[model samples]
Target: MWQQKTIHLAEKPRGFHLITEEVLAQLPEIKNIKIGLVHLLLQHTSAGLTLNENADPTVREDFLQYINRLAPEDLNYLKHTYEGDDDMPAHLKSSLLGVELMLPITQGQLNLGVWQGIYLGEYRNFGGVRQLIVTIQS
Candidate 1:
């Protein structure tokens, strides 16, 4: 079986946000698949998707801080400056972090580690609503 859907995520500020529950909430059909794979694609160039620590909020904060250092918006070499200061840096950060994720599904639930959860890396200061294309295959 194969299924696909596009879901809109609420706007978020520049930071790393835990969105595992949000994604699951939008896909109740996932419970019907005992074994499968869920593929998530963030349909934007200024944001990213990843799996990481869910037990602590500080981990998300640290992620935002570290990522900003890796792709600071103050770089004078950026040519894509028409959007804004955060625009070019957002693209750089998105490329480094990526915009897709694939996770295993088992026993009618996501087979993520105990401390693992899906994260949305909101690279832009005002990224607004984000769109995600979720595909499930079993």
Candidate 2:
């Protein structure tokens, strides 16, 4: 059986530029770690995932600003009135941004590109807990 851990995403009205290595470290030990696949999924609809440049904080900031400009909080949006203007934009951001990712694991670790990292893109105003399902297979 594979191992699992639930990551509690911090309240990020401003979005999260986080590293996922900590979560991966929690997987069960396996031998002959020749080939494995890691699957990640965000439990919230308003949140998403992106595999992007990890070396430069500027890259993360640039990407985040770009997305917000692409999908700004619309006061004119109706659905937002209920959850606030950020509501619809959150869904749009999540949609335009996306969710779920499959990573290739090699040598008992993830084979990510140089300067690449996994981030939980939270588009909501109030963030409390987000669930991440991690599966390690041999």
Best by lDDT: 1
lDDT of 1 at 33: 90
What tens-digit string does per-residue lDDT give for candidate 1 at 19-79? 9999999999999899999999999999999999999999999999999999998999989
TM-score of 1: 0.98
How far is 102's C-alpha from truth in model 2 (Å)?
0.3
Residue 35, model 2: Cα distance from true site in angstroms: 1.0
Clashing pairs in 1: none
Best by TM-score: 1
Q: What lDDT does the true structure give each of the candidates?
A: 0.95, 0.73
User: Residues 77-138, candidate 2, lDDT per residue (tens digit)?
Assistant: 45554676777777888888778888887887778888789887877777556777766666
Worst 10 residues of 1 by lDDT: 74-83
